[model samples]
Target chain A: MDIKLDQILFQVLNFGVVFGAIVFLVYKPVIKVLDERAKKIHDADRAAEESLKEKDAIDELKKKEKVRAEKESAKMMEKAREQATELKKELTEKARAEIKLDKEKAMKSWELEKKGEHAAMRKEFVDAVYAVTEKVVGKAVDKKAHAGLIDKGLKELAQAM
Target chain B: MSAIQISISAEPIFHLGQFVVTNSMFTSVLVTALLIVFAVCANRAVTSTSKNSRFRILVEFIIESLQNLTTGVVGTGKRAHLFGPLIVSFFIFILVNNWAGLIPGVGSIGIWEHHGEENIFVPYFRAGTADLNMTIALALISVVLTQVFGYSFQKLKYFSKFINFSNPLNFFVGVLELVLEVAKIVSFAFRLFGNIFAGEVLLTVMTALVPLIIPMPFYGMELFVGFIQALVFSMLSLVFFNMATIGHGEEH
Candidate 1:
């Protein structure tokens, strides 16, 4: 085959044009899109990772708050128990003191009643004896002298009974 | 039926001033226009908002595959990106041109012209790589671009690869290397041209022998050969480029 210099030159120039057009039209634009897609994916992954970390931190804070609340409530319950015990003991002691006072008042009233009864009994006995002596020996003794001796004897007898 | 007539050179179809436009050149121009149109459409599809269409996906797939093929040889860096389009262009350009002649009407539909007593047929389109001129041009471009890449990477130090003068044996080896570089042009041109032209001749002969079902297998073979030649040309170019652009003493 005959190799023509002109034809070769023509081809070389033709290829140069084709190469330039293809680069401008196809290669550059496609590569840019691909690069942009890759960048978007990378950014999305990073955002997901950061959000996950934030969620973890929030979860940790919630856990700490719950634990602290539980501890505070427990302390309040313990304090409530202590106060309840103190109230119960104070009420018991106050009730015992009131009962003791009531018993002393009842004892004092019973002794007064017993003293009145005894006096009554002594008077009755003196009257009975005076009547019997009068019937046996009429108007033998003075009433005032006998009255004083009889009162003295009756008081001793009543005290002895 | 008449005997098969195969010409070694592509027949001249028309003239432009003093310049002769051969059939292969016309077909090359057609291939160029087709590629440009395809690129524009692909570019439009990619830049548009709705790129999930099947056509767009296909376009993207093709470009990605070409990009992957390129990066495999040149590795992923500024150099790979820089040289990727040019290398892929070689594959597209050669492959389409190689297949263009195999079309039904391309070589068969032609005008008969008088040359003395006999009439010679002049076709309107021939495979671009079937022409020796086109292959030589492509080879020269590949080799020359390799040198340019080498210079860009190594500055003046790249010449040492073929011009060493330190010792007698080293000088001889350097001279041999320089000769090999020049020989590469001849080898590249002949190899592609020989394969395509022979395939053309073979198909023509086969069609003449049996016009119907006999040449079908030959057509399939030609298609495979076309793809293979395209791959070989582009891959060799890529290898040379890779070799040239690396540091002088650095291992690949």
Candidate 2:
């Protein structure tokens, strides 16, 4: 086999040129593309995770607000029930006082009417008695005797008083 | 007697200022120019946004596969990145050189040289790796680059692999390591040259014997051998690089 220095040198130079060109034109660019792709994927993952966290935070806030709203509604409902109870009690007391005043006024009116009726009946009875006495006296005795009896009764009553 | 003849050395085709250019050198130049053109085209085809073309896809596939292969051999971190491009380029160059011999006109078209009333045929093109000079140059580059990687990564610790003087046993071991390091260049050069040259000779013999239909299997075998030899050469370099990057005893 022939070993020539010139051929070895030329081959070395050729290889060096090939190595440099391939590394520059092919290797670097491919690696750069791969790295950029990896970085993009990493960024996307991070963004998705951040969005998920934000969504969870918003959900928690909504839950808290819902709970607060429910609590306020319950409190308002309780207050309204208490106010209704107080209003019902006030109305019942006013109704009872009005019924008591009506009953007292009716009792007083009834007493007055009974007194008037008794007075009228007494007057009638008295009138009838006087008429009967006058008739009997007129029929049985003289008018002068009747008048003397009446004066004698009057004098007795006065003495007894 | 067979009329076919094979030369062991790359035949000189022309001279430029006392510099002789061989048929293998011509092939190497052609391969290099083709690779450069391909690189430019592939670079243009690959864009960040989209890679839909078949050429782009094929180039991307090859780059990814080579990257993965280098990572597998050296490991998956910094050293892989450092040595990946070199090893991949070696593989591509060697594989192309090996396969370039399979072209129809390469071995068939030649100039006939007359020697004492006998006509001897000389081919115009031969595979680059079949030349001992080219393989030797590639081996030198690989061995030297391994040292460069070792020094760049391990710094002062790299010399400890060959300069241990604390004990006689360790010193002898270090000497042995140094000798083996030099031996790796010989092994690398001879292994590639032997395989490719033997393949070329085998094909020549087959073609001479049968002339047709019978050399097909040898051609197929040469193709397989070319691919495997390329893989083997690059893998060995990768292993040596990996060994260089780590501490001496730390290598498993």
Error of 1 at A118 (Å): 33
Interface Cα RMSD in Å, per prediction: 1.0, 0.9
Instruction: Give each model's whole-structure lDDT.
Output: 0.87, 0.87
- Candidate 1 residue-wise lDDT, B1-252, digit = tens: 985678899888999999999999999999899989888888888899973777678877766778888898778998888778887788888998899979998788888899999988888888899999999999999999989999998888888878888998888988998998899898889999999999999999999999999999999999999999998998898888888888756743
Model 1 agreement with the true structure over A7-28: per-residue lDDT tens digits:
9999999898788777888878
lDDT of 1 at B153: 88
Model 2 residue B230 lDDT? 96
Span of 10 residues, lowest total lDDT, candidate 1 chain B = B243-252
Instruction: Kindly report which residue pairs in candidate 2 clash with one another.
Output: none
| Candidate 1 Cα errors over 4 Å, as ranges | A51-161
* DockQ for the candidates, in order: 0.51, 0.51
- Docking quality category of candidate 1 according to DockQ thresholds: medium
Model 2 chain A, TM-score vs. native: 0.45
Point out the worst 10-residue segment of candidate 2 chain A by lDDT: A137-146
lDDT of 2 by residue, B1-252 (tens): 557788899988888988999999999999999999988887887764574789877887888888989887777788888888988799999999999988878777889988899888878899999999999999999999989989999898898879999999999999999999889989999999999999998988888878789999899999999999999999999999888888857776
TM-score of 1: 0.75
